[model samples]
Target: MPPRQQAQPFAKDERVLCFHHEMLYEAKILDIQPSEGSEGGYQYKVHYKGWKNTWDDWVPADRIRKFTEQNKELAAQLHAQIKHLQKSSAKVPKKGGRATGTDSARVSEERSSGAVAGSRGPRRARDYDLEQEDGFHARPSIKLPVPDHIKGILVDDWENITKNNQLVPLPHPHPVDQIINDYLEEERQNREPNSAHFDILEETMAGLKEYFEKALSRILLYRFERPQYHEIRKLWDQAGDDGPNKTACDTYGAEHLARLLVSLPELVAQTTMDQQSVARLREELVKFTTWLGKNAKNYFVSEYETPSQKYIDHARSF
Candidate 1:
């Protein structure tokens, strides 16, 4: 028999409040996707309690909180208290703001009465969730730990990309550009002048530069420019001999490189004029991947899941 699916935190038909588009709406769990990584790693598809199909979508487990009547009452009571406080304060004269002894006693009595009146029913999941949400809402809008200069970069260069009202961090163009340039110069000198080999080498070098640079820019913009890449700052940080854990940006860079290396033949088939050029480009791709794998195992490519089968095949081929 097939192995049993891992258990999920929330089950189907459970009432929840989902955070979507920065707003919380009542919803119900329709399905659960078990974690492929660790516990508490489930994703859920939910239908908003009163909305149409358009508003229905999958949300992360953390983004969906249990909706309870007790919590609802607590929220209502909190709002009512705030309203009461506002009204009581407004009654004080602007010229002489000190509260009279009678006024103070009356306000205290009202507060005590309100608390006693609303203190009913057992505590629910909503109570705990609301407490957490209060802290979450109190924090500054931007969640990423990026600096002002980084924010400047986002505003000036990456005006289009942002998440949670904050700028996503950019990935560093490490060793990739340097490796390609250094190889190009070394190969250029080593090639025989006025020969077909030299011509192929030059053409392949140009093709590889255009391919990698364009691919890197697009990949960085599309993948790294998101709040999900918050750990991306670690990629820019200088580490000791035993470097820090690989960041999301690092994995992305490695994946792109690996995919590019594996897909070289297909890419070369389009732009390359001769088999000689294709062969030369593939050789360079191999060198790049080899250097990446040796020098940066954690970042470039790990035994972890890769982007495609071709990447696996190519890495094994080398």
Candidate 2:
């Protein structure tokens, strides 16, 4: 029930008797948490009337909202709708050899109901994981290897690219690195004046594939690696004492905005340090920093520049 009259602001520690959870619940801001691990949003601690501790619960600022009696009615209506949908969907025979509908719901039902067998696997063939998973974090699929006949001509193609640039990096001792180096070196040795231009093109493609695969992986892992909420809360709590990197952790992303006007300086410092601590920062930067310039005139830079697998997968495949 909305208050009969006005209850004025319930200042801290002030209280009155409330018979029901519904009567006096409105979203009131607690405090903005700056150092919590999250991205874009006001990181708030809120008090909502709907919580287990409705009178005094701290929730993410985005999560706080008013509760209504109609919520149960809405849920019941949705359940009824789902049941009707399932009944209509069940009419199609489970014994049908193929399919009757295009919806994923139907497709899922067919699979569960044994309408389709396991024999029909994925249709569009994919190569392996593009990020080498084990260590190199390479692509997960097989690169279409140039056949031995084309391999010879492709070697010349690589050397031709080499002349335009400088010497390629010598392969490191790792078996994977060595294999890649061997392929490139062999191509250089056997380059005919008339090496098949297409073969060279493929070799150049191989170089591109390596760069893109690593660069994309590094970007993905860094961006989604963690959120700012809990991390910030912990650091904020700790900084009240003393913790290393406290200044850096509280600075970047959502941390920048939420903590409070007074605490903004510390949060800013944390953000800068957080960005600097990005894993393998320099190595990741080097991988594809020059890629745009190298392939400025070409199409499909994303595809061609990504190391298709380089020597790592070829070694694995062989």
Candidate 3:
């Protein structure tokens, strides 16, 4: 006779609290399958209660807890913590050019949530720590091989804005959208027009562009860059009816785009993407960042312009 199968703890359609990254979310068990490992276990397919179905995925048994009164309280506490974090981080600095304390936390939250200007709402928090049975796994951290030169660029960008109070001149020579298009064109040249790889490449770039446009103002800017951002907004508003459909991508350049690239791993970790999907995303991101590094001299400005006294005053007043 075949060895007896282990009994499943949770059945299909059961409401449960599912641990995703660090936070626990209310979810429903959609399906259950026996684990393939020699040690008998189960994997559950779960749909997060309020999230889109696209976020549904298989989770291991250890990640699920019964929706008891105790677990429900735990979930509520977690939700409260998320709200507190967002509220605390939402405060922008009024005087400093540097990104410090709450400013950095705000950027992390905005990037993780893909939040754009004036689009604040409840979002998932990924900062909690959870200890597992075998060992301690805090949160899912993605490692992207940002090149050494790219690391240097990030450091310079920070110092120029915070320490030097200098800014990239407006209407950059290679705006972010154009850079993305150029990368796409290069990708297309090497692949068949109808190839699946090319299709994925196009899709990935499109998503990246969307994320950049949404994230630039909310998370990519330093406290000093706020004046420049306001200027761009003012121009867009002044143009009114005749203004072209413009976004941050039309104004900012590779410098800000580089900021977004470095923060992507943290942002990606906050999502419900499966391991395979996350791996694929990391591959594409690494490729794009490498490409960006190669063209840095052309895309990035050699001399950042010093902000005028008026601009400095405006930034300080904010």
In terms of lDDT, the best-performing candidate is: 3
lDDT of 2 at 263: 23
In candidate 3, which residue ranges exceed 4 Å CA deviation?
1-141, 240-245
TM-score of every model versus the real structure: 0.27, 0.16, 0.57
lDDT of 1 by residue, 1-318 (tens): 434554465789998776543234567998887655443356799887656666567776645555765334323433343344345545747785664432233234334434210111123433333433343333322111122332333233322321222222224344344455555676567545754446766666566556665544323332313223434445435553355434432334433444344334334444524433332343344434444444453343222221344533432332
Query: Ten residues in a row with the worst lDDT in model 3?
Result: 129-138
- Highest TM-score among the candidates is held by which one? 3
lDDT of the candidates, in the order given: 0.44, 0.28, 0.70
lDDT of 1 at 229: 42
Candidate 2 lDDT for residue 253: 15
- Residue-level lDDT of model 3, residues 36-125, one tens digit each, is 767666789999888777788898775777797755755565455445545554676588566653335447545555544201122434
Instruction: List model 2 lDDT by residue over 1-318, tens digit each.
Output: 322332222333222221111112334555553423433233444443244333444333222222333323322333343344345545766675564311222224334534321011112222112122122111111112112323322333233322332111211112222233433554354333333322543444354334323322122111111232234446657777564333322222111111111122222334342322221222112212222223222311111111233433432232
Worst 10 residues of 1 by lDDT: 114-123
For residue 165, model 2's alpha carbon misses the true position, in angstroms, by 55
